[model samples]
Target: MIPVFVGMMYGATLGGNATLIGSAANIVAAGVCANEGRPVTFARFLRYGLPITLCQLAVTAAYVMVLSKFLR
Candidate 1:
C-alpha cells in the first residue's frame, strides 16, 4: 500500500513535468513566463527534477525498509 501510494505520487509529479501545461494553472503560468523571455524547457526542468524525484524515491524506499524491519 505504501509503495503504491509513493508510486502514485511519483507518477503524478512525472506527468506534471511531462507537459508545460499539464496542470490548468500551469498553462497560464508557463505562458506568462515564456512571454517574459524565461520559458522553461524540459531539459531545464529535468536537470533538477530528476534529482529531486530520485531523492524522494530513495527516502521512500528507506522508510519502507525500516518500517518492515521494525514491524517484523
Candidate 2:
C-alpha cells in the first residue's frame, strides 16, 4: 500500500513536468520564455515533453516495482 501510494504520487509529480502547463515550474518557465518573446507553445512543448515524461514515468514505475519486490 505504501509503495503504491508513494509511486502514484511520485509518478504524478514527475509526470507534471511533461508539459508547459503540467506544473507550476513549467508554467513559470513558459512565462519567462514568453517574456523573452519565445513562448513555449503546446506543440513546442509536446515535441520534447512527451518523450521525457514517458521515459521518466517508465523508470519510476519500474523502480517502484523493484522496490516493492524487495520490500515485500
Candidate 3:
C-alpha cells in the first residue's frame, strides 16, 4: 500500500508539472502525505521532480525523433 501510494504521488506530481492549474494536485498530494505523517516539503519534491521531469521529457523527445526517422 505504501509503495502504491508513493507511485501514485510520483505520477500525480509529474503530471501536475504540465500546467499551472495542474499543480494543485501536487500540493494536495503533499498535504495528504503530511496529514499521513510523511510530509513532503516543496524543496524535497522539487529535488526529485525536476530531474525526473527532465529525464522523462528527454526520453519522450528521443522517442519522437526515432519514430520520425522511421516514418520518413
Per-residue C-alpha lDDT of model 3 across residues 1-72, encoded as one tens digit per residue: 544454455566566664423577777888889999998876778777777687776665566556656655
After superposition on all CA atoms, what RMSD does each candidate show versus the true structure? 3.6, 1.1, 10.6
Candidate 2's C-alpha runs over 4 A off are none
TM-score, every prediction:
0.54, 0.89, 0.59
Look at candidate 2 and tell me the lDDT of residue 41: 92
> Could you give the candidate ranking by TM-score, starting with the highest?
2, 3, 1
Q: How far is 19's C-alpha from truth in model 3 (Å)?
A: 10
Q: How high a TM-score does candidate 1 get?
A: 0.54
lDDT of 3: 0.66
Q: Where does candidate 3 have its weakest 10-residue lDDT segment?
A: 1-10
By the TM-score metric, which is better: model 2 or model 3?
Answer: 2
lDDT of 2 by residue, 1-72 (tens): 979898989888988888778889888888899999987898899899999889988998999999998888
Q: Score residue 19 of candidate 3 by CA lDDT.
A: 40
Best by lDDT: 2
What ordering of candidates by lDDT runs from best to worst?
2, 3, 1
Q: For model 3, what is the alpha-carbon lDDT of residue 18?
A: 47
